[model samples]
Target: MSFLIKNKLGLARTGIIKTAHGNVETPNFAFVATHGFIKSLKEEDYFSLAPELTISNTFHLFVTGKHKEIKKAGGLHKMFPLKNPIMTDSGGFQVFSLGWGKKHNIGKVDKTAKNPACVQPVDKSTRPPARDVSKTTCVAGGVRACLPTGRLEKDRNPVKILSDRVIFTYDGKKFELTPRKSIKIQEDLGADIIFAFDECTSPLHDYEYNKKSLKKTHSWAKECLKAKKKNGQMLYGIVQGGIFENLRKESSSFIGALPFDGFGIGGSFGEKQMEEVIGWALSGLPENKPRHLLGIGAIKDIFIGVGKGIDTFDCVIPTREARHGAVYSMEGRLDIKRGVFEKDKKALDKGCGCFVCSSGIKRKDLRILFKENIPEAQRLATIHNIHFYKKLFGKIREAIDSGKRSNLKKLEKHYKF
Candidate 1:
């Protein structure tokens, strides 16, 4: 459990994270395999793509009853046939999302966009204002009236937040997930890396409520650390404070002072607050340990994060975007389903050196393959996007090592993100 930096330029560095399965290169991108596998791609597909690491969701695996089977089969890499390392989330995000966010018509991580279908009448006869909406935004009070229709939908079973545990009701049954339970589950379905159970608060939560929740999350962080087993799995303590600067600093100080192997920056926030919030949290953390920025995978965000000292990131964006006919290239995002690409004979990306482009596969052929709705198109598109991300990290690392970090700034303007 050692994170040794090999090179550094400003806060960004190229490092090696020592893990049980293997070493993960720093400033790396982890492919999202939420349900034990990336969508539209099988275990065999990963062998060729060979991501240095993959992130799985604990909530999905536990609810689907796959955790027991995976534990019995040994570990994620062995059970899933992946040669690289694996990291499992504490499922805290789902708890907030399925319960609070759903009830209030808010998204877990997204805040910029609005959903039109989520509009519903505000129920004034329900809960009191103290427990309902706030002055600026409706969190609990007037939630139905204040929010846009596209962001929230009415749901019956959302999670209930208690001081010690989160109650999730699904399919007519209730499941109580405590801090200790989350750690035990992660240990059961062993992965090279695991996260401490903490409350991932929504941005809609006001400062007073976020402050109270921060105290609860801090309590859970200690409980998780105390309950965690030293079975060679690296445990990462998560920092949560919504978007308040003072709370962010406090949460960072509390979580960073702990003896966990690593640290993860968690909680909901808008795009404008990302860099400033991250800077606040990172300022409190020790420079020696690895720091993972949770649930961020956009290219522009990557540049911002790496420059500010984040070591790793995980998101479902690339693969999910690929399934929706979007792929990343050096030029920018390419939509294979576009009518223009139906006859375009050029490669998916002229500057891309991935197998799909390097093998001379034209955009028209790829478009037709994808239009046929075959699995190969999705897989190929996913692979190309992944390769682009991997290469991006590689270039970032190289720029840092060679003392030419300005190249990263240039990429920001070139990509226009």
Candidate 2:
């Protein structure tokens, strides 16, 4: 429950989160450990990649029956042997994206595209259908390799949302994920930071639907706070209003007035509306408390969120994108699998100081790694990309500390959201 801010440059501030496991530096990235572990990397590898915090999915863990195992192992830090702080998402985004998105064949977050074809599948691959080898992935270097998706399969147990609870159907059995239940599960799993259970509506949801959903979110936020036990774990109340400004202000004000430790900016918005809603929410939130913008990790998005006073962020983009050969460069993303890189001798980013780039691995060699389907290739790319994000955020903090906001502005040309 101890969060201290040591410095502020405009809206951006440097801070630390004092948790039972360890302290996490602010203006930091929280990498995704979707099902209680980072994909394609071992627990020890997390120590080397060095994000101050990691986030796990509450819904995924619950569905996969890992929640009980996680608890039995004495919470996430002890189970994973991570010395850093841990955060558990409320499972709202996955409910909206995987369950809700699949039900309607709508896009996960983008609101502009009405056609289902315009929506990109959550998986980026165009390869032919493969077997469902997801559960039988090989363990290498003491880490379980992540399984790639096979044929697009409809979610057998789509999440049915209601005002008080969400019904999840998995394995032919129905499970209810209520606000109170979510809190208890997270408590048992015991992350340093956990979010209140709230409904995360798709960007495709209309204003009327969003308004109705926000009311439920507010009620749940209160319930989550009431259900929280005094265990020194930080509970962040989620703000949900979709893309509407008025609703955003109302939702923010209600959640911000509560004595919760921090705030999580939830729900989805059109790309053009993202900044406005984020600004509105931050305007109403308590400045002394930290704010986490959920499920956004693009470099431009990070810059925008940081500028808007968001203290922390968690996204699957760095590692997920790297697994697909989309890598971050100061110049923007470099798709290593592309033919252009097949014979290119230059490093992924000559200016980068990451292990891969520092080792002088050329673009052609990187392309070969993915082309030949080398397993370590994904891990190396993930490490380098994560390292790149670390460096990027470091630069962001430095720019803010030195009042070089213009440098951040210039970066807009390279990293467009």
Per-model lDDT: 0.79, 0.77
The C-alpha stretches of model 1 lying farther than 4 A from their native spots are 103-105, 108-154
| Cα TM-score per model | 0.89, 0.86
The true-versus-predicted C-alpha distance at residue 99 of model 1, in Å, is 2.2
lDDT of 2 by residue, 138-241 (tens): 22211111133433343243677777888877767778888889999999889999999998876545667677888889999999999988586999999988
Clashes of each: 10, 0
**Residue pairs in clash, model 2:** none
lDDT of 1 by residue, 1-417 (tens): 678999988888889998877888898988998877778776666777788988999988887789889888876876786768889999898867676565555654435322211121223222222333322333223223334333333334457778899887766677888999999989987888999888887655556667888898899999999999757899999998877789999999999999989999988765566788889888788899999999888888888899899999998888899988897876678888999888898878777888788889888998898888877999888888888788888888877788766776665676644
RMSD of each: 4.5, 9.2
